[model samples]
Target: MSLFKRAAVSEFASNASVVFSTLIIIWLSIVLVRLLGEAANGTIGADVVLGLTGLTTIAALPTVLAAAVFIGVLTTVSRSYRESEMVVWFTSGLSLLSWIRPALRIAVPAAIVVGLLTIFASPWSHRQIQEYRARFELRSAISQVTTGEFLELEHGARVILVEANENDPEKLGQVFVRIKDDPWHSVVVSDHAKTEVAPNGDRFLVLEEGMRYDLTPGGLVTRLWDFDEFAVRLDSKDAEQTLRQSREHALLNHKGRPTGLLLTDGKSHSDGQLMWRLAIPIATINLALLAIPMGAVNPRAGRSFDMLVAGLIALLYFNLINLSHSWINNQTLPFGVGVWLVHLVFLSLTVFLFWHRVRVRAPKNPSD
Candidate 1:
């Protein structure tokens, strides 16, 4: 390649790397905070938080790649103009079209990475996320119990509280339990509670030195039982089976389904998902094209105005992509119409800007 093309490509790649790194760090920080919150709320396991965060970052890669490529093109080209390098290129018989070659070099690799992410890696990561959540929810209720927290299980039919753990976290101390059903209320207090998993995989919370009090609705009498040990099964067999079925059904959710499945399926949500994946690569190139013209700043005035316009355009395009996906998914717009409209519009704008920059800016004949 020519030295000029080589230098341009080098600058574009460097800028993309810097922008990509910054965006990833910011995005990962936000995702980690949210995942930690989920772990703390007992919605997910603390042990799986890092794994989930990594998967989330993978799922977010395509958008980050697209924006980085966009900004990289914009910044590199704007810097060239600001430094009068474009003037040098123009004086040497090079036109705005010469920028396309270097931009394409960067865009092609970026788009390929985006295609891999959106087509294969992203869907897989999303499935992992779903499985993590499903398993976390399906774990035996006793396993989710933490010291000094009130936990409700069996659809709020029973509540368990552990005031402290004496020897080990697995062995609870000063426990309180409450059970409420149709016409009865039961409360139990124990000196300590420990969990035992039976040979059949059934889990029981065994309370030691506990007294149980049972009160029936509209009855003046209450029954009390005092025992050295008490055992209660944590979850019914039916609930486990139901949870398995729900998780199986979740595979059909948009995030859980693979890109290949989404491509073949005719459902609106699936089509929207598949289209959005395909759109990323195309939009990446189109945005790079848009930025070339946007990067052409009036050397007299500050280049900030040009940068402001580019930022607005990039933001507007990003939001439109999302809005179009929602509209297509909800059947408010036809799939083909909704998916391609934003890209086509921006691509057309890019073409017009390039034409104006190349033709209108050319020196006119003195006679004319």
Candidate 2:
């Protein structure tokens, strides 16, 4: 490596680290705030919130890294130009295109990391997140029931209230249940009931010495029954393992499947995902190169101008990528054109900018 290339690479990397860290910290703070509400609502546990945030951050790292590289190169080159250091390099016959070498040195590694995250780590994290949500949903339905408070379950299909004996979790002294089913309304009052899980793993509230009154909805018909003991299932499904298929496979799982499998699946959704994973890394490189010329700044002007422009470009690039994913999924655009076209357009833009920068004459300082 040339001395100039090594110095440029080091400078870009140093700037990138600072920018990347700041962005991640800011992003994490915003995410934590959004998740805190869910934690309070019991939708997610406090411990799980942090884990989920970390996983989400991992999933988001590719775009973050891409933005970092773009801003890094832009800041480095813009600073050099603002301070008139670029004039010295240009006079020394280093063309504007030379920035690609140093930018790539930093970008190639970032791109590889992005690839690993998009292809493998991100998908795995997504699967973990789905599993966490499924477990929480299943448990929340039962856990919301509290003694001494009337609780509505299954969107008010049933209502139950229990008054338990002092210092006993299982011994309830009074139980009331209101059940509303089509064409029937029933109320039950029990002297005492014990909460138990049956041998077959069914959850039941077994009532002793209970009287049940039934009324036909909107009718004069009524019935009453006295029972020594009766049991009602607490959960709609028996208290046994209920297997649920995951929805994460619709997006992330396809990345882990063999490329051939995706091709054979004959699903547009799978094709869209496969294209997305492959495109992210390529986008990283294109954005990196594009950042070099975009980062160039006038020595007299402040660094903020180039930074703003770089941000806009990054925004547009990512939006286009996301739009492409949707287009492919909807079959509005062919996968071949939808996925790679965005990268190609940006890559061409980068090349044109580099060429224009090379042709444009640099202003001279007479003192030099």
Candidate 3:
């Protein structure tokens, strides 16, 4: 490789590393905070926060790496222009268009990695995340209860307290349950309690030798009853339904579905998802090449102006990709047309910028 190519590729790699590292840190921070909030609210368990954070990061890497490559190319090229390196290259018979070769050297490999990540790794990560949540959902509420602590269920609508039975490890002693049913409040005290699973998969809390009291809100009415065995049904049906919905939603969710499955699926939403996955690699290459021409600026001009324009262009390119996905999903745009339209537009712009920059650098005729 030539010195120029070597230096440019090395510098692009370094800049991308820095940017990728920074972006990953920011992404992890955001995911952690959100997961922690969910844990606190009992939406998810604290134990799975780190696992979900890791999986979430994996799922987001393709977009993050695309942004990194775009910024890295822009920074490397703009710095070259800013520091007068472009003048040296120009004097040596290297036109602005020559940057494309080195830019692609970095971009092509990065795009391949992004492609693999988006197509395979991302979906796997999303699947893992979904499984984590599904397993948590499938856990019975009674399984989370401790012997000595008061466990509240249904947002404190029902409160239960129990003691451990030394004779029977699986049984609970001195069980107390308080239920608030709006107009009526009931309390139950039992000598011992245990869980029973019916043949149909429903769970019940079986309280032995219990006394129950029902009280009215105004204290005008009271009822008492004694029982040898009291059974409280727990809704296994609701849990089963939740588990079913989660699986269905996962199939419906494009991000969680594998690329192979997506290809086989005939749904328009799946096609939109497939387009998005395919577009990431293409966008990575386009944005990297586009940065070359966008980064050409007058050395004497304000540095921020060129950077601002480049940022806006990158933003627009990504937004258009998202818009294309939306259009395909909504059936407003055909998949074939939507997939390449935005990319072709930016590619043409890239070609135009290269031509315009080369023309501006061309020497004038002595007669004109």
TM-score of each: 0.92, 0.82, 0.82
**Candidate 1 runs further than 4 Å off:** 167-170, 236-247, 361-368
Candidate with better lDDT, 2 vs 3: 3
Question: Judged by TM-score, which candidate is best?
Answer: 1
Error of 1 at 49 (Å): 1.4
Q: Which predicted model would earn the best lDDT?
A: 3
TM-score of candidate 1 versus the correct structure, residues matched by position: 0.92
Candidate 3 stretches with Cα past 4 Å from truth are: 142-185, 189-210, 214-223, 226-245, 360-368
Q: Residue 236 of candidate 2: its Cα lDDT?
A: 47
Instruction: Give the worst 10-residue stretch by lDDT in candidate 2.
Output: 237-246
Ranking by lDDT: 3, 1, 2
RMSD value for candidate 2: 4.2
Better structure of 1 and 3 per TM-score: 1
For candidate 3, the per-residue lDDT at 187 reads: 97
Per-residue C-alpha lDDT of model 3 across residues 113-207, encoded as one tens digit per residue: 99999999998888788878987866656666666788887788888888888888888888999989878999999989998888877777889
